[model samples]
Target: MKQSEIIKRLSDKELKKQVFLSQGLLLIVGVGLSFIFFDTFADWNSIMGWKPKQILFYGVIPGLGIVLLDIFIMRIFPEKHYDDGGINKRIFKNQSIGFIFVLSSLVAISEELLFRGVLQSVFGYLIASILFAVVHFRYFTKPVLLLSIFSISFLIGYLFEVTNNLYVTIAFHFTVDFVLGLIIRFKL
Candidate 1:
C-alpha cells in the first residue's frame, strides 16, 4: 500500500492514539534508560540542569527562531516539499487549543528525553542526531523534509551538548511543536 493510502485510512482519533502510545513508550524507555545508565537518580537529576532562565534563553528563543524560519520556508517553497502526507494537519486541525498544547508537550518531552537526554548522553551527538532524523521515517522520501529534520535534530542535539540541560532542549522542542501545531490548527 502507498503511504498516502495508509494515511487516508487513519482517522484523527487513531492517529492521536498512535501518537500517545508511541510517545508514552518513548517516555518509558527514556526514563528506564536513564535509570540504567546513571549511577543514581541524582546523576539523572544533575544532567537535567533545570533552570528557568536557561530554558527561556537557550530553548524558547531558539525554538521560536526555528519555527519562524520554517514558516518562511513553507511560504517560499512549494507545498509538496514540506508535505508529510497531511499527518500533522489531520492530527491537529480538528483539535482544541488545549489538546494541541498537551499533545505537543507530550511529543517534545518524550522525544527529547529519549533522544537528547538518553541517547545523546550515552552515545554522542552525531549518532543521536542521525537516529533522530532516521526515526522520522515519513520524511525519508522527501529530500527537503529529510534534510530539515536532520538539521533540526542536529541543532537540538548541539543545544543539549552545549547547555548540558535536558530542560532547555525540552523547552525548545515544545516551543517549536506548539507554535507550529497552532499554525496547523488555525490553518494559518
Candidate 2:
C-alpha cells in the first residue's frame, strides 16, 4: 500500500485493531525467528525463561504500571497530562503522574534490558533502537519523537554499558520513570 493509503488504514478503527493484532503476530514471528536462527527462544537461557511472567514483569508491566499511575493522577490534575507544545498524543497522554512514574519504572527496567541489554548488546544499538522505536511508532510520527526514542534508548544503552548490570539500567530507568510519574501525578 502507498504511504497515504497505509496512513488512512491506520486511522480506521478496524484497521487499527488489525494493526494491533498484527503487532502481536509480529512479536510471535520474532520469537519464532529467534528460535530458528539462534536455536533458543531464551537467547541461551532456559526455554521457559521466555515465559509471560518474565517478559511481562521485565518489560510490559513496569512501563504500564507507571502509565496507569499517571492516568490516576490526571483524574485530579488534568493539566499534568497536557504538553504545553501539544505534541504528545499517545494513548497515555492524559495519564496521571503516579501512573507515569510506575509506567516509566516498568519501561526503564523492562525496556532497557529488552532493547539495550538484550537486543542492542547482542545485535547492535542502531538495530535495537530502531526496533524499539518502531514497536512504539503508534505513539508518534514526528522526527523529533523518533529522535527522542533513540536518545532514551541510547541512555539506557549507556547504563547497560557502564555497569554491565541489567538492574543498573533498570534502576536508572525506574528512577527516571518514577520521577516523571510523580511529576505527572501531582502536577509538581
lDDT of 1 by residue, 1-188 (tens): 98678768887788789889989999999889988887877777876876999999999999999999999989998999999988998889968999989998999999999999899999999999999998898998887898889999999999999899999999999999999999998889
Question: In model 1, where is the ten-residue run with the lowest total lDDT?
Answer: 41-50
For 1-188, candidate 2 gives per-residue lDDT tens digits of 64435655453345435534654565455545455556453443432233444444443454455456545644655553333223223323456665565555545545655565557656875787678777766435444445555665665565445444555556556755565545544555
lDDT of 2 at 1: 68
lDDT (CA) per prediction: 0.91, 0.52
How many residue pairs of model 2 clash at the backbone? 24
Candidate 2 matches the true fold with a TM-score of: 0.47
